[model samples]
Target: MLRAAMTGAIAAAIAVALAGCGAAPSNSGEGEGPVRVTTTIGQITDIVTNIGGERVEVAGIMPSGVDPHLYKATQGDIAKFEDADIVFYNGLHLEGKMTEVFEEMAEHKPTIAVGESIDPASLIEVANADGTQVYDPHIWFDVKLWMQAAETVQRELAKLDPDNAGTYEANAKAYLAELEALDAYARERIATIPEGQRVLVTAHDAFGYFGKAYDIEVRGLQGISTASEAGSKDVTDLRDFLVERKIKAVFVETSVSNRSITAVIEGAKKLGHDLKEGGTLYSDAMGEEGTPEGTYVGMVRHNVDTIVNALQ
Candidate 1:
């Protein structure tokens, strides 16, 4: 019912915005300047900005530390979408609240779902509450998977701006090679944390792909979507798992509240186990702009360094 109401509101808002949009701008007169590209998350924004180089002007609606799962589109965001020459987002419902907006805008623009291009078989399938399987949208957590996303962005950009096709391709190739190096670095660094200390407990299930790629055990207090609550049972179960394994640290997420993880910590303490916040992980969003974690590669590196240092 809540989802229905939110959807209704977004639909009405989009309708009004479109109604007031007046005449559509001439597609041919888009001008000989930077291709205005609007992306959903900072990770996408960073890659697009890098790959687009001087050919595209990239902007993201969701800022650092903003939870994408529950982010609702506003009038300003709708205007951004309307003005953009191209739009890119991490699909598979990562931006659950903005699905309608994306669908509506894709009608006339090159709105691309970067994550959807990856082969479905390569995606992690998890059962939903209603017993339906869905692909995990946190593909960016795995550097290799994110390479696929980078390629998708390049393809779309090249298609939209054919004159700059060579540049986009070259940039994508360079970025992909960097991603390969990042993947190798993650594996090497994570392997140094003794086998028994490979467990990564966090606020939510955002690190599944990360764990799968690096051979670590990941457990989270809440589900993949932060919209779901972590009940007492969930916290108790995680606390018991921490106590039984004697895990010393659990990480908090940038986009999620620390309360749930804190509860698990207190629960573990009550059961004669001591735990601390391992570190803050960038789950749904990256770090602040102008910082190292602001970029995707840097974000992944920071997470790996934090986890390895804490768990080791």
Candidate 2:
């Protein structure tokens, strides 16, 4: 979830944590060797870097495990945007606070919103309690949709650097095939769980697409946006659902805090259900660099393994 509603105290703590850490300004030096590109998140960066190879220098604005919804651009990030030959963002307002900034930068450079290029009808829209639809920006949760997004990025990158079009297309095709295999693997792994226990309760509502793809029932403590508060009603409602279903485990996200999930555990305990920590699931962001879940494919595989081990 891109949006995070932080209390004043929490906001202050975050600010203090970020204080005095300076990132490099945008890369400069006009004499072109490799084209410079900027990505809003690590997933985009990884794909771009993979396809571009050594022909492009790519920088990711949001680090691994950082929440995109609440990410604020710093002075260093502005420089990176200004210097890039192309910019890639997840789109559908995933970079909630940075949307306006990216829009402004798009006027000066080639900017691609990968998610927006995918057909809207193909996307799964989230609904409010009254059933009104909002675009679910977490399309990467579904491997099929993510492959589409990767193609979109490949097309844009090829357009920007036509000299390397063949390489980009080939890499995209290979990566897409890997993504397809990953989807098959996830389906098989998830099938090992009892049919009735295919319920997935997580820290936030980021897994609607995952549920749709894998035939699992997904529930979350918070709404689509971490910006929203997890009220008493939300906790109570989830607690009742867990108890009714006799769910044994639930998940915590990589980027989001575990406070709300802890509340669910407590609620389940009071209701006589012996719930356990299912394991940490990578939700909003991938794992740390060089880890098994650092790349897109690795992240999905790790998620499947964690879910299967917990539920089986």
Candidate 3:
């Protein structure tokens, strides 16, 4: 599908156009100017924009509410990659289908894997039935961890366009400060929920980092990646668990279908527990471009407030 989406003319243009990368914009007067940054997901796009500020022209592949795990790049997306001076994406197979596209682009330009900066020991590893473990790619849920990603962005931007190094530095410092406050807010607000009622049930386990960082027990009907389906047994198991614990709500995600979650809710009702839909949480994706939930900090803030208001 990827090749089909960007075949013949687009593929032929990549090699020729890539030779022109890292050049200043047409109007920038002969020096390294604004970096043409193309990112795979909106979370990474938000980070690049915040850290790079006015120094980057970012084109994000997967927009708000698009699931990166299931996203397949289009012809236009391929063109964005070709035009970019640098490409940034969440690693650990988050953008699974785009792996080949990233590989092809990295050979020509400064393609960065954002998750590389994070410590492996700190990652949440989900074990498959075959006994292999894949590290969770939803690192943006932990504000502190996400801050590291922002730092990575600024560091790379400084390297790519040295003339604007100071600007990137200043922007990163300010953004990191806001992230610190956001992290504290998450910890404190989640702490406000009654210990027993603090359980967060969502359709997918994208919030492992959030739950771990905030000291809440998180249960998901599905696994880490939304690519996996929530089976009937999964629903029954979660339903019984919710009924046993009397969990008041289970949240749905903006990027994922809520059918499994709805099933869980209905099943809980049949078992005599009136479980409510807490609210929609931003999981693998965010809200629209101009909305509060569009940016990383805004998305995190919204999720924290929603969880706290629902459970506390």
Candidate number with greatest lDDT: 1
Better model by lDDT: candidate 1 vs candidate 3? 1
* Cα RMSD, each candidate: 2.2, 5.8, 3.2
Candidate that beats the other on TM-score, 2 or 3, i.e. the better one: 3
Candidate 3: segments with Cα more than 4 A from true spot? 1-32
Candidate 1 minimal-lDDT segment of 10 residues: 22-31
Candidate 2 lDDT over residue span 54-149, tens digit each: 778988878888988777777677567656778899888677776656555555567799989889988877764335567888888888998888
So what's the TM-score on candidate 3? 0.91
lDDT of 3: 0.83
> At residue 184, what lDDT does model 2 achieve?
97
**lDDT of each model, Cα atoms only?**
0.85, 0.79, 0.83
Cα lDDT, model 3, residue 187: 93
| C-alpha lDDT of residue 168 in model 2 | 87
- lDDT of candidate 2? 0.79
Per-residue C-alpha lDDT of model 1 across residues 1-312, encoded as one tens digit per residue: 012124677667775665554345523224468888889999999889889898888779999999988888877787777778788999988888777777777766677999999999879987544466778889999998999899898888888788778999999889888999999999999999988879999988889999999999999877777877888999988999889998879999899999999999888888788898899888889999999999998999999999999999
TM-score of each: 0.94, 0.88, 0.91
Alpha carbon lDDT of residue 307, candidate 3?
94
Ranking of candidates on lDDT, top first: 1, 3, 2
| TM-score top scorer | 1
Cα error, candidate 3, residue 295 (Å): 1.3
lDDT of 1: 0.85
